[model samples]
Every structure is written in structure tokens, then in C-alpha cells.
Target: MTAALDAIDRAIVVATQDGLPLVDRPYHEVARQVGISPDEVMNRMDRLLHEGAIRRIGVVPNHYALGYRFNGMTVWDVADEHIAEAGKRVGDLDFVSHCYHRPRHLPDWPYSLFAMIHAKEKAQADSLAERIACVLGDLSRGHLVLFSSRILKKTGLRL
Candidate 1:
């Protein structure tokens, strides 16, 4: 399990919940907000990753603003035993921004693999989904594409 975050650590998370600054010294900016040194911010982030408090620290560009108008959360129904392998293959695709295995919901929802695809339009997103299907091959029993009409709430992990 991840370690409990101290006050400073929690402050860091709160300050960065929206995102890090766009300036060259984003960490320094975060440090400035958290009332700590830049090195301390780096050390805390390193510890967060090391202790499983955070998986990674990186940039998240505004996809829609960048003309990536279509984003699809593609779900797949795959054999539970083979989902791990299939998900890895899906995750490796250049078009797949993110992919992972998830628990199934039985009757109404049976997807075991979820992959996020970004494209400029719906056709392109669907094409990428087709490519994913080709990659999953016989392992996938079925699939569905869920679209997002607008941004709801976007945030990384919180303490």
C-alpha cells in the first residue's frame, strides 16, 4: 500500500491537482506554492513514486484544444486468463494513450480491458479501435466504444 501523505506532501498534491505550471521551472513553482525548496519538491515526488504514492509525474496536454476532438474509452470483453497479455498488446499501440485490465460487471457490463484512444475525429478513433480488435484477435469476445461529450472533472491522484 502507499504511504500516508504528510501535510507537505498533501499540499503538493493539492497545488498540482489541476496541473503543474507551464513555466520552465514547474517544480520550483510548486515548491514556491508549498513553501518548500525546489529540491525538497523533487525529493518528495521521488519518494511518492518510490513509495507507490504516485506512479509518475508528467505533462498532460489539452487534447481537445490541440485538435484531438475525438477521444474514446474502448472496452473489451476478453477471456479473464488472457486479458493480461491482450491488454499489454493494446497498451503498446501508438494510438492507445492508456490501457489496462479491469474487473467485469457481469450481466450488463462484461468488459475486462479498457483502452483510451485519441483522434481528430470519430472515424479515426473507430479505425484505431479496429486496429485494437485486430491485435486482440480471438482473445476478445466483444467490444464497445464510450465517448465523452465534454470535460467533466480531470485530476490525478489525490492524497
Candidate 2:
């Protein structure tokens, strides 16, 4: 990640950190800005991904802007020993945006598995939460859900 980048690489990073142009040929446009060919842009991107310079390159839509109003964070008090396997199963759920195990704070917070569920309504999110609960089965001691009343725009990090 250090010696792998040059001026042109930095230029491409700057051009795309926010987003690729919403055009027929966004890579071409980025190449033009970076003083390179479209194929060069693609090649560099491929290299970056192959070398693990970047985690992922993809579109991150604003679910709230797309009418997904009910944003819920579902938590489950899963056994620490079984958390890894349970998180994997929950992450595979279609309605689950992402699921991972996190450190839990005792005396108040006891949930270890966390997943974000999105839907157009509260009821829909609740239903999705139930599905996740069923998947967890008797593995989890309990579960809780909290929904956001307002949209929280997620602007992917750029630098």
C-alpha cells in the first residue's frame, strides 16, 4: 500500500474516492482525468484489488433515499464461543445488510452479535429481526432491536 502508489495512482484514488461518474463510461472519464487510458485505469484497479490495496469497490446506495425508512440494529446475546458461527449465518441473511460480532460491555450491554436490518416500515424490520432470531435458535440467550426514526446518510470514507 505504500510503495505501490504513485502520482497517477493517487489521482485515480482522488477521482474515485467520492464516486465514479454516473456516465456510460465512468472508468474512461476517470482515466481522462488521471491522464491514462481506460484500460490503464482498469488495470490499476485490478492490481489494487489483487494486491489488497483496497478492500472493495462498489456502489453504496443511501437506503433511506431509496425509501428504506426503517433502519434497525438487531442485537443478540449469543454465547461467546458460538458467536463466530452465528455471525456468519446472520450475515448471510438477505435482509441483513451486514452482521458481525462485537465486544460486549457487561452490567448493561450483553449482546455480542449485531446486524443491521433495513426495510420500508417498522413492521417489516421487525419481521426480518424475527427471521434472524429463528436462525439463531436456542444459541442466543435473548435479542433486542432498536430502530432509527430518521435517516442517517452513510457517506463512505474517502481520503
Task: Compare the candidates by TM-score and give the number of the best one.
Answer: 2
Candidate 1 total steric clashes: 0
Give candidate 1's whole-model lDDT. 0.89
For model 1, give the RMSD to the true fold.
2.4
Best by lDDT: 1
Q: Give the alpha carbon lDDT tens digit for every residue of 21-93 in model 1.
A: 8889999999999999999998998998799777677767778889998888999999989988998899999
Candidate 2: clashing pairs of residues: none
Cα lDDT tens digits for candidate 2, 93-155: 988988888899996999999999989978888899999989989988998998876765656
Q: In candidate 1, which residue pairs get closer than 3 Å at backbone N, Cα or C atoms, i.e. clash?
A: none
Query: Model 2 reaches what TM-score against the true structure?
Result: 0.92
Per-candidate TM-scores read 0.83, 0.92
The window of 10 residues in a row where model 2 has the poorest summed lDDT is: 150-159
Which 10-residue window in model 1 sums to the lowest lDDT?
150-159
